[model samples]
Target chain A: MTFPADLVGLLALLGALFVLLGSLGIVKLSSYLLRLHAATKASTLGVGAILLASALHFSARDGGASLIEVLAAILLFATVPVSAQMLARAALHLHPDLAPPQPDSGSRQTVPEGAEVARPNHGNSAPADRL
Target chain B: MIAIAMFITGAAMLLAALRLLLGPTIEDRVLALDTLYVDALALLVLMGIALESRVYFETALVMAVLGFVATVAVAAYLRRGRIMP
Candidate 1:
């Protein structure tokens, strides 16, 4: 079973590029929460791409599909969002001031649970002062 | 081609490490560590492909599982001030 070297190379190159972008985002983003968003979202896709390239490469080289790479990818995909959510909550808990202001409208929907717990009076005041 | 990919992956890991070192808060450090592990996993997979070896794949799998568990545990600790409620 022979595979096109160029095709595999392309996948690997793209995967590496995305992974680099994600890490660069972590370094470049100003705030902790935005960095979390960047790392989790972009890096998950980046790892997925690399795993995909590996799966394709192995399946072609060995004449059979590689289940391990697929499983690893699935495990990563399943856990990233959960970890990101937990970390975001933790960040909010540790620093409620980092939470962005509620929309000008009366209703407040996106406030994190940790923010509510940490700053009960945060609802009435301006986040800028807190920051 | 694969060598270039490996080089890019290595650079990513270095950038993540820089964040881990210079991050102001615990949450930032944790986020940086998480990104580091994920990039490490990607690097392992790329290594497996480059070396035509199966062991790197298994190592990557183990790393993914461990990294997820560790991140969750740390996050839980940060949120509730305890690993277990």
Candidate 2:
């Protein structure tokens, strides 16, 4: 009922809206990568906003700044991208077919057959086992 | 107003669960689960505000750590067919 309460409510509402939109994208998006984009980026922002609201509300109520929510926000922001990257790499390793076709570039350099870059196979039997 | 936010966040979790159930690939399911937990974190924070309690914030923090570890472990398994190898 106070100004701070109103602000908290507004921030919470906006955050929830963003979260819902992200989940909707997860369900509605046609491609796996696109869904990843939605899940990681949008939901991170949404949760960050919600955490901000939480911090604000507690700080106002306690008459002192609450930084716990800020810590949570920092953790969320730091980890979301790491998890997203790992998930994407896993998806690519397991299901390379899901990747969109590479756009043909006119100036793309063709690597010499024997000069291709060496990458760790992560226990796969052969170097060229899977993309 | 907090109630409305809670309702919306619950709906978002439901949608994420739907994706988790019907996802076409393992990665999609993992991603859905990831989103679901993030939404849960937000909901828990909202609940904290609504109840005027700070206890929920600690639980939310733990959830964030656990969720990150779970997602990463699953992703590593998917890629290597083993988590540690």
Report the number of the highest-DockQ candidate.
1
Q: All candidates: CA RMSD in angstroms?
A: 8.2, 7.8
Error at A38, model 2, angstroms:
0.5
- Model 1, span A1-131: residue lDDT tens: 23556777888899899889989999998988889888998889888888888888888888887888889988999999999999999999989988987654324345644564343564676554432
With a 3 Å backbone cut-off (N, CA, C), the pairs that clash in candidate 1 are none
Give the TM-score of each candidate: 0.85, 0.86
Grade the docking of candidate 2.
Answer: medium
Clash pairs, model 2 backbone: none
Can you write out model 2's per-residue Cα lDDT over B1-85, one digit (the tens) per residue? Answer: 9999999999999999999999988888899999988999999999999999999988999999999999999999988889997
Model 2 residue runs over 4 Å out of place are A105-131
Clash counts per candidate, in order, are 0, 0
Question: Could you tell me the lDDT of residue A41 within candidate 2?
Answer: 90
